[model samples]
Target chain A: MTAEYFMVLGLLGVAFFSVAGALLGYEKSISGFGVVVVATVTALGGGTLRDILLDKPIFWIATPEYLYSTYAAIIATIFFVRYLPHVNNYYFLLVDAIGMALFNIMGIEKALISGTGMVIAITMGITTGIFGGLIRDVICREVPSVMRNEPYASACLAGGLVYAALFTIEVDYIWCILGSLFTTVFLRLGSLHWGWHLTIFRKKDFKNQSD
Target chain B: MTAEYFMVLGLLGVAFFSVAGALLGYEKSISGFGVVVVATVTALGGGTLRDILLDKPIFWIATPEYLYSTYAAIIATIFFVRYLPHVNNYYFLLVDAIGMALFNIMGIEKALISGTGMVIAITMGITTGIFGGLIRDVICREVPSVMRNEPYASACLAGGLVYAALFTIEVDYIWCILGSLFTTVFLRLGSLHWGWHLTIFRKKDFKNQSD
Candidate 1:
């Protein structure tokens, strides 16, 4: 698909994941007010950070559509939560993955367009991919997966590196997007199944620490 | 006090608050990782949001002193948390007040300098004052006081309106800042003492069901 197509899809993914996050928070017994807070963060957190770093008007404030979509998502989650059961968990993962991939692609493109070097571009890509989820977790009072043993950030890193490498080789734009998405999806799924993670610290290191 | 004095004091206040936040977060019963996260947020959160909204280089990154001060604060907190029990709560109120006053004044000034009209300037000032705390509360998994019944945003609104009025009347910049700070501090203190709040919702309002 073209870049523009992916960007629109990404925005939709953000809306979907936001609702999913709210549903999950509701199931976890988070307060109604807390659910709205988490939903807003899950939807707009990444884009807000990206716009701030780029020194641009916030995307949502500039265009009302994002805000409207987020509001709709929140309302939908609040009203429809009781009807759904195990479906939310599966939907959360799917929407999260889509949002992650879309954000990574858009972030890389924006950084490149701003004339950033490969290192900064990749960093921004990874940041955009995971920042919304990080904000969601932080707001839910859970340790952000990125700061823990999860391969969440690692998958973004791999996708970003792939995008950068492909761009360097002057690969076709469509192929680059596909390649990056494939890399992220594979890494994430494999990690989930095989329990893959970065070796940040050994279990022995924290053996003496109280839990 | 002169504008320069206020600026210097504000910076120093930022340093003090950063240290205090880090120390409070590092208490014996607190998780070490959580402490670092909260400390970082409490220290730089307000200024970061202010700079981002103003589209300026982040104040801390532009001047490394902020980072240095935050690190120093963290270290000091770690070593001295046990010695100071009541200090934590008192420090929270004090530093928060100082930060609020300084940031509100600076945000209005910056907006005025950027050629925004009085209304926009007032809005920006109020936003700058509260955005950081909103972020912090969200991260702490609490409903943001601004979104709830707290008079936090209302106090900002009052202060900003007073500042705008003074500026429109061609008052001295010093008087304007003092007037705004006074209005904010008293209103905020009064709110806390009286438990004043603005209820955005009424129980009867929800009876309409999607009107």
Candidate 2:
């Protein structure tokens, strides 16, 4: 029953991820098949990448239900966008943060179970959280917002650290999961809400004579 | 002995891939440690991704020599670019094509050995050939050249088909490898030399009022 519940939750999160990705594609003037492609990648790309990097069986391949949710979400999003032409970036950020938070904890748990070190586990967690958006932005030909915009990966990193700390102290695994998820969601949403930004390295930022 | 020889060849190809990736990062004004990261990804990302999708051990993780060559190439290219200010797009295209051609065959061979279908094998071949540069371009905030600039993946597709046809017809594996490599390199180089391009979809291309 728990497994089934998590599966449903995972599929729902994938749907949100698909919609966020579709919105990005819509903004880029990508139409029809392109939006589907973007949405599919956005929803499945992160766990796929994480699984690949960890040399584990791909999640969506093992359970094809995720693909169904992704497709269904894209179709629904397209219709919703047609009626609501003003669908904006804020909506994208909101859903994206939720998905990222969910994936962050999932990644941390997976990495830990895989026997990776804390640092690598944290990195994997962040990779899971942001790679979907990173791939989305990359295909859309924009500097990955993870690198330039607010602290997306940083939020994941912070959450992963919290989870690790809790685990190290012999806390219940369930509490550790909740703590990490709460931390990730809080930081991610806080950044969006307060318009927090991280400074990126720019050519002008360096005053080297060689440059 | 034959496996050792192939290992050396793969590492050499990785070096070239690293240099091409570093040159791209240089062109984009990404300096220092960032170039190393980009070059490493360009050199290892394709094979790593292919292995991951195939649920196999990552090639670079299994063989650290590739990473050494990638780092060595990045350092060499940093020096090469410092003295050569006029390193242009043509140089990038040349090395990139060579590396892509090498990876195309490697991907096809791996996929066939993994017992994937011909079409999926060909798709994997194209993915290996172009994904490194695609990732590089994405990280640099450019539309992937593979998608827009020319017939990059198409060349890999042609080569992969040649390999599949030859294998199906009971051609010697050596001949099949050579045929595929030659076709991919020839088409890729030919496209570069002749300034060939594939037209991409644009807003103006479709006259639909719904658009």
Candidate 3:
């Protein structure tokens, strides 16, 4: 697949996750302003982090297409707010995971192209992949799935490593993207299917305080 | 003051907030690893977001002093975990506000130096000021004060505007810093003293769902 194809996929990912973010916001008493902000944050937050860390001009600033995409997503969400009820019930994980899978490869490739080491590339990939949803979930006032038992960040990590390994072995770059994408989507889907979860540990005397 | 002075002050801010972050971590059943990660994230999260959005190399990568300070703070927290209970009682707000005030100016200056517009500079200032604490609270499973009715981000916003206005009027940079500093600190202190908070409005049919 061409980079343009990936870019299109990434844009779709942005739209999907922004809708998810807007839905998350709507569950609360989030106003229209809040919905727009949350949608943009969810769609662009991770890539913004990646671009900033790479010390490159932020992607959206250079290419207004991304911002336009986020705006479009927010507008779509606002118009369809009433139809967003079951959004959190089943659609959240799928859209988020798909977006994560696409963004993960994009971040790894960007980091590698910028001449970072393999470890940093992989870590950057995961950071770019999950950061948006992490911030979105946090803004929505829930524990991030990565911090909880969900296999979110771990899937990104695994897929990033797969991409790195493939790229290192002189595999076709397209294959690398596909391989990594499938790994992430399958891992997340498999986890959901089997109810796989990470274990939580606490101090011997964990105190739960209500704020 | 000299750049070195700001550097020192920034490091001190990082240490103090890392201590505060670890204390927050300890209040839960978070393990030592969790404590360390939370400390690092809280100490560096805001600046990381700022630098990234500004398209600069992260403040910590070029200078490891900040990370070392965070480490020192986390080490202190680990050894003194037994004494962290009272940390959340009264000290949390003071230390967090002080850190926010300092970091707020630092962000504004950095943005100004980067040649961003006044609006972006102010936004970045507030972003840098409160992002760490916001993430810290979220990670610690509490609502971020700024998200609710707290005057935290508002103080930073007011102080950032003060700094921007002073700079626009060609005031001495040191005076700008001090002016903004006092504004944020005094505003926060006043808010705490008089129980000032923003009024929240929930939509009549808001739905609460666990994600």
Candidate 4:
């Protein structure tokens, strides 16, 4: 759809995923303060980086809507955490996918508007989709999903390429957005269900260093 | 000191603190892959924020020196960690102080150069000094020093004010740098030594409902 519509969707995605992140943090027995920290990071961290890289004044600092939305997410999660034991893991994956798709579209659109080439637009899109989650994992002292075998950044990359292809073909903007979103969702869900993973290591002939 | 000298010192501070952060993360059982993430955030996070807020291209992206220095720092720490176990905590504090002081001075200087008012400059300086560490702590799933009952931000604020005062009085650049550095170090060390803290929590007689 339009860039304005994408921005609105991106904000909503952030608010939703922020709640999901907070719930995950609560499940991990992270402190209340820690939950808030993780929630805000999951929600605002990607968009913040995107704005910074684009040299735009931070969207949240100017609008206050993002901040209030994230705050609401955190409060909602905290109050509902006890009643939501089994929902965290599934919700995490779902909301994360939504956030990744929305951010990918928004970042690519912004880069295109800034007169960047398709390659740079795709790079920025993947960066926007994954950087926040990477930051969140690093803060939570967990290995980021990117560094793992999981197809996290891969999904983003695929979605970004799809978006660029759709744009190049002059497809309707709505169809382009849906195309990218479905690609990311299917890739992520398939990876989760089928245990699909990238092979990052190869058998080494060398002995142990101590030898 | 000349502005060039301060910038170099600040870079060195970033290098040193990044190494120190890596070592601490290792000790905390943070994953090997995550060490690089932590180091990058601890070292470059604040300046990155400052550049973004100023709508300037990120310095490290342009110069490459900052990234190279951080890489070197990580390698150095990984090799030296075992031989320096007892000193890790001390080194962490020392490097943190140096980085904070240099960042505080640099941030204030940059703000002044940009023609910002004294108050905003001071605020930016403190924010620049502390935000990286705040990010680092959050990633490590620890309570940020700022949120704790510590004088972390207060020390930076004090140093920033001293820098502004020196500038107002037309003090020589070298002496102004020294004044700010000394003020920051003394305040930070004194706070740690005597458990000094700023008054942050107003009395809450009612249920704590605010998020």
lDDT for every model?
A: 0.69, 0.77, 0.78, 0.76
lDDT of 3 by residue, A1-211 (tens): 4668767867877887787777767767687587788778988998998887878888889889989988988788778767645556456667777888988887887887787667667767877888888777777777666555557777887898888788889888788988998999988888888987543334444344322
For model 1, what is the error of residue B179's alpha carbon versus the real structure, in angstroms, after optimal superposition? Answer: 18
TM-scores for every candidate against the unseen true structure:
0.58, 0.60, 0.60, 0.61
* Superposition TM-score, candidate 3 onto the true structure: 0.60
Model 1 regions more than 4 Å off: A1-3, A6-10, A85-88, A165-171, A198-211, B1-44, B56-130, B134-211
Query: How well is each residue in B30-136 modelled by candidate 4, as lDDT tens digits?
Result: 54344655677788888878877766677665556666787688768766765444444667777788788888887787777777888888887887899888877
In candidate 4, list every pair of residues with a backbone clash.
Answer: A139-B139, B1-B174
In the range B1-211, model 2's lDDT, one tens digit per residue, is 1466457657766887998988887667664344555677788888888887897877765665676677678888877775666677789878888788778877877787789998888889888888888777768777787656677888888899898899899977678877887888788889878887666665664767556
lDDT of 1 by residue, B1-211 (tens): 3557655745764665566456445433466667766766776776777677657788789878777777777677766766866665556655666566667776777667756666556656765676666666675655555544455666777888898888779887778888988888777767677876554223233334434
> By DockQ, is 2 or 4 better?
2
List TM-score (chain A only) for every prediction: 0.86, 0.87, 0.86, 0.91
lDDT of 4: 0.76
Q: Which TM-score value belongs to model 2?
A: 0.60
Candidate 3 or 2, higher DockQ: 3
* Regions of candidate 2 where Cα sits further than 4 Å from its true position: A1-9, A25-37, A51-87, A111-127, A138-143, A146-150, A153-165, A186-202, A205-208, B1-23, B29-40, B52-55, B60-130, B138-211
Scored by DockQ, the top model is: 3
Clashes of 3: 1
* Per-residue lDDT of model 2, residues A68-168, tens digit only: 77888999999999999899988988888888877877777677767766765776677688888878887787777654456677788889999989989
